[model samples]
Target: MDNLVSVSLRERGGRFHAVFYDPDRGQKWRTLRTSDRREANKRIRIAEDLVSRGDFDPWESPIPDRYATLRGAADLYLAEREKGQLSRNTIRSDRSALGGLCSHMGPAAKVRAVTSDRVKLYFRELIDDECADSTLRTYHTRFKHFFEWCRRERLVRRNPLDGVPRPAVSDALPRFLSHAEFDALVGAVYSDAEAKARGVVDGERSKHTSLHDGDIVWLAEVFFVAVETGLRRGELCAMEWSWVDMASRSIWVPANRRTYSDKDSFGPKSRRSRRVPFGAGSGTEAVLQRLHDETGGKSGPVFVGQRGGPLDGDYVSKRFKEYAGQAGLSEDYVFHTLRHTCASWLVMAGRHLVEVKEILGHASIDTTVRWYAHLDPTRLNAAADATFGRNGDRLRQARCGGR
Candidate 1:
């Protein structure tokens, strides 16, 4: 056999070993199958010849063609998702969760290499980093869906997430602004606009655009409409002049205006379209009329940027936070808090869950109940009185000698 540079022999425990440099396994040192020195040398030469021929792959267990890296499978999964009717928001969330996983486990790490233990550890790290349990649960769901897809695609032998437990999320009620805080926020918004108009507040600009007097006033109007009609921020931004019916005193939330993108128009979160009527003497009609007049009855978006383009959601959220803070609201206050506030106030005012659900354009009544059920203690109390009140009173009289 020809001499090989990377092959050598070593004596250990009275046995001759053939040691060779394997590009894949780093270095291979194995006892020769034969005890004879000539046989061990021959084996070493054969290994070296394979290495030189570029045909040696020393991986003990070879990866199958079905195995895919996390990143590779995610690309396939997301491509599949995009081809379907999945919302852009859902796809964005999936991408975000996939990014996190790719960061934790190397992007090139095989999907089959992931185990339940790794998933548990990843969540542990997230919790340690102070990620909310709710957020962790979202991550868990994204991973679950990804793994399920991988299993169906045969990219993984089995779902690594099978035995992994979902992170427990709290059933805490959504936060909403109080009546006093709501009033304060409104005042702050209007007052800020007035100040900017009067030159008292000068050169106050947002990252996206300048906060003009009209923009501020429009935002205030948006706030009022949000409180009255329970429209989401994106919905408000997507609202067109044509959707408003002054004669009928109603606003149509078209199914097409749900998404918030760089486009001129987008769709709503709920794919279904519905109408929200201005309540009898709710004064919401007046707010819409004034907004229409203030914006010069534009044919396009009711709320626009300084350049009269589609309103930037981030700008609105930033201004909302600025005004909310000035109102002395809690730090956790966000634009969505207004929607929560609307539902809470409705429930407190004795509106039915179904009514709130319709106003909010929720897909189901259960969603409305889960968020606002705690606000309706009166209704629950009434039910309790109807079901157990008399029976409990009789039992109490029996125990207390009718005292």
Candidate 2:
């Protein structure tokens, strides 16, 4: 008993508890859920063996029935999410979405008590609360993971969310700026830059133009780069000077490394690295060349704050909104619209979906096609012509004459 490395038995709440030290998690105190001393001792030995093998998460492996509450399921799910190497954003979002569920159904609600009917009713209430369909779908998606974990762990006989229907998401055409609007937005930024250079001091406008003159010019270039490369906001911000291959006129988007982190551990959302070419006529190459000259070949972020830290994505978005407003664009035109604008223009210019998919770094051609299908004039025309071209008149006449 003394050799078993801090594993000991104790009595708590009329049950024997297995108490031990877990280096990864601090001191762990688990109820044996049995009054028998022999069973408690055996459990302690098992825990010691599990810890030695480096597979001793109290939340996983040989899951116990006591962890059958909604709260327990959530804890276990989040624990697994961490272990599965999910991104921080995904883990944070799951916790938030599931936290709402635990609050609605008391935390103590049994996993076995969660029926499909109960899930359906919960979504009905969410719908009535004026939650957006997309938001409702997200909650449903989170619960689906929880329920699947519960079923796999045998906490529930079946996934209660299995039969629950997800909210129908409307595939509205993505909001994007037209070529004219994009030109106007970029022009506005440069216009302000010109005024700043000329020392036209509009006191109130100064607050809005607080970014350094160089940053204002860079923002204009960012717009050009975004439209040319179609990089995600984070990908663009996380970009480093080294990743920009000026000779090839390409930027390499590295997989899963946080450019904003003190440590370079956080990566791209796509979890994959991709090389995006700067468009031939977008003038992005020249802009990047100027940026390269300005940065003096030192390895740092491609975009940085005035104080010399990496540029924040949110701040960039806020400034873009201000720039768009100055150009008389709609409030709904967001930074992401730059991406959509690029994709739209590509399809409009008769580029194949495969080409668009590669440039945008989309995982699937279906995704590229779905979003930009409307902009592809040839796709629909080709489909119609495939069945109705050249021989269609002859076929129609033969059918009528034969009848």
TM-score of each: 0.72, 0.71
Error of 1 at 258 (Å): 5.2
Q: Give the per-residue lDDT digits (tens) of candidate 1, residues 1-403.
A: 2233356788777657666564544666655433457745765676656656656543342212212578877876887787666666678889999889988999578888789999989998998999988889899899999998787655667887788988775977799888889889989988888776655654554344345577577677778788888888778777888888877888888886344456323466668898987875665777777777777665887766767666877788899999988878888998888889999999999988998899889998889989898888999889888998799778988989956
Where model 1 places Cα greater than 4 Å from the true spot, the runs are 1-67, 198-212, 256-260, 263-270, 280-283, 294-299, 381-403
**Candidate 2 lDDT, tens digit per residue, 1-403?**
2233366688987678776654555666766544557756776677667766666655354424435688876876787686665556677779998888878788689878889998888888888898877788888888888788676555778887779888887778787888899999999898878777655545333434444467478888889888888887877877888788887889988776553744223465556788888855557887788778987746988877766877677778998999999999999899999999989988888888899888887877888878998787788899789987968799999999999
Q: Count the backbone clashes (under 3 Å) in each candidate.
A: 8, 6
Superposed on all Cα atoms, model 1 deviates from the true structure by an RMSD in Å of 12.9
lDDT of each: 0.76, 0.76
Strongest candidate by TM-score: 1
Clashing pairs in 1: 256-267, 257-266, 257-267, 257-268, 258-266, 258-267, 258-268, 259-267
Residue 8, model 2, lDDT: 68
